[model samples]
Target: MKTALIALTTATFVGTAAFAAVADLDSDGDGVVSFTEMLASYPTLTEEGFSAIDTNGDGVVDEEEMTAATEGGLIPEA
Candidate 1:
């Protein structure tokens, strides 16, 4: 049980770290992620793909959008 708990905790930490890494890519610190900023981190992602993630036609991906994309497997699970 202890081992499982430790593993869960570690996974949570790693997931949070990954999210933070992506969040840190917001060079402008606009509280939202722009395509250019996301592209800087994920070179393989295209503008169209980013559009899908943006979800609200806002031209930016906010934290809720990012979380939904990640959770729904629209983006890779971290």
Candidate 2:
């Protein structure tokens, strides 16, 4: 499953019309969402959008940023 997402890492991306939970996408249980991890939930999320959601530019999206993205109309709400 993860490999499939990785294969599409550089593919065209956009927002999906579904709600994605951080817990569900945190496949490694690392407390932060990596690009591949996010792909599972947001199959069409672009690298640029992920960068925006990451906020700190740490290559990972934390809970606070996820909330902000959804609230700010960047990502769809649950």
Candidate 3:
């Protein structure tokens, strides 16, 4: 049971790490990343680039969008 618990804890961290890029960007912990938040990590980011990452054009980037952009090489992994 102890070993299983350890494994579960590690697994959870590893999974969360997949979104570590946004984790650092979303300073408000609102579960969504905004343009200003993205700029902090990607200094060279432009409005066009941000729009591309925003995907749904909702004016914010979420975990799924962050993952896609990273996996697609649109943004660097954090």
Top lDDT: which candidate number?
3
Supply candidate 3's per-residue lDDT for 36: 85
On residues 1-78, what C-alpha lDDT tens digit does candidate 3 reach at each position?
A: 999999999866755764786788889999888988887878788889889888999999887887777666777433
lDDT of each: 0.77, 0.70, 0.80
Q: For candidate 1, write residues 3-48 as lDDT tens digits.
A: 9999999868766754675578678977778988887777788888
TM-score of each: 0.67, 0.67, 0.71
TM-score of 2: 0.67
lDDT of 3 at 63: 79
Separate clash counts for every candidate: 0, 1, 0
Better of 1 and 2 by lDDT: 1
Stretches off by above 4 angstroms in model 2 are 1-20, 76-78
Per TM-score, what order, best first? 3, 1, 2
